[model samples]
Target: MKMLKEKIQKEGIVLSDTVLKVDTFLNHQIDPQLMQEIGKEFAARFKDAGITKIVTIESSGIAPALMTGLILDVPVIFARKRKSLTLSDNLLTATVYSFTKQESNDISVSKDMLHEEDVVLLIDDFLANGQALKGLNDLVKQSGAQVAGAGIVIEKGFQTGGKEIRANGLRVESLAIVESLVNGGVVFAEESVNK
Candidate 1:
């Protein structure tokens, strides 16, 4: 986690008070070593959760989620943002609003992927407004699966997402929590704690 924090400090771009772009080493061009470490961290944190499956939304969430799944030796399932012809009509669907994209999309998961016996661990690159996680959780619920918890690579603590998800009784773990991105500066929650 310290290495991740350092990476953010060095390469992350502060776009605004509400936006911190980490595409250099995270979402866009990836650092495999860092992602492996992150996967290890999540596996350690959720080691005893009896996770039967790893769930995530498509795009940005896939990398970390795939890494986590590899570490956990569990199958990973990602929700598709757009319905495709290859996808069957028998699916669990949920509408999610992306605060960053300023739009909503209907995400879906095939019913065959999840089951009532599954204990799911949700993984993602970032947690902003919690909409994506909510939608994924809804899909899991529809499948009668139990949510083991969630592991997030970066959490915008200043936003309502993390808090709201926690309040909903989901065990959430984040590697780097940004307390603020005020005035183009990154302030981490751990830094405040260490102070």
Candidate 2:
């Protein structure tokens, strides 16, 4: 986590008070070593939760989720943002609004991948508005699966996502939480005391 914080400090670009871009080593051009460490951290955090499956969304969430699944030796399932012809009709769907993209997507998962007997751990690249996680949670609920918790690579603590998800009785573990991004400066929740 310290390494992730340092990476954010060094490479992250604060586009605005509400936007921090980490495409250099995260979403766009990924650092597999860092992602492996992230996966290890999440596995350690949720090791005892009896996680039967790891769930995430397509694109950004896939890397970390796959790494976690590899570490946990569990199956990884990702929700597709767009319905494809290859996808089966037996699916669980939910509508999610993207705070960053400024659009809504109908996300879905195959009913065959998840079931009532599984304990799911949700993983994502970022947590800001909590809508994506909510949609994934809804899919898990529809499948009658139990949620273990959520693992987020970066959490915008100034936003309502983390608080809202926790308030909904879901556990959230974030590698690095940004308390504020002001004037191209990044401040972590723990480092706020030093300011």
Candidate 3:
């Protein structure tokens, strides 16, 4: 996880008191090595959990999801934020409020993609307020799949989302947890555990 912390320290930008823009290596510019490392890390943590599928939201989650899928040797499925002409009407949905974007978007997946027999592992690039994870968890529940756990690339440790999700008794793993980003400096959680 030091790799992640180093990347944030070097390339992450602060847009506001609450927003950390990691567009350089995470959300925008490609970093295949880092992405593969994250995937391998998640795979190692949940390797024995019987995760039949890995679920993530659109855009930012795609890279890690595919990488994780390769590590797990299973399929990765992404929930589309918007429905295009090809999205069927029978898709399962959950509305997610993105605090960063300050907007509500519906995330959905085809019913055929996930089923009752699946054991799902959810992944995302960031976990702030837990809204996106909540929506994805809802989709997992609706499909009758057991949520094996969730793996996040970066978690805001000072935020309530990580605590709230952990309180719900689901396994949660974060590679790099930011305790604070005060005065243009990144502070990592001291006692953070990667697995």
lDDT of each: 0.90, 0.92, 0.90
Best first by lDDT, ranked: 2, 1, 3
- Select the stronger candidate by lDDT from 1 and 2: 2
Candidate 3 segments exceeding 4 Å error: 191-195
- Top candidate on lDDT is 2
Error of 1 at 53 (Å): 0.6
1-195: candidate 2 lDDT, tens digit per residue: 898999999999999999999999888999999999999999999999999999999999999999999999999999999899999888899999987888999999999999999999999999998999999999999999999999999999998988998989999999899999988899998844212
Tens digits of per-residue lDDT for model 3, 61-180 = 989989999989999999999897987898989999987788999999999999999999999999988999999999889989999999999998878898999899988999898888
TM-score per candidate, chains pooled: 0.96, 0.96, 0.96
Q: RMSD of each candidate?
A: 1.9, 2.3, 1.1
What's model 2's lDDT at 185?
99
Candidate 1: C-alpha RMSD to true structure equals: 1.9
Please identify which of the two predictions, 2 or 3, would achieve the higher lDDT against the true structure: 2
TM-score of structure candidate 1: 0.96
Backbone clashes in model 3, listed as residue pairs: none
Clash number for every model? 0, 0, 0
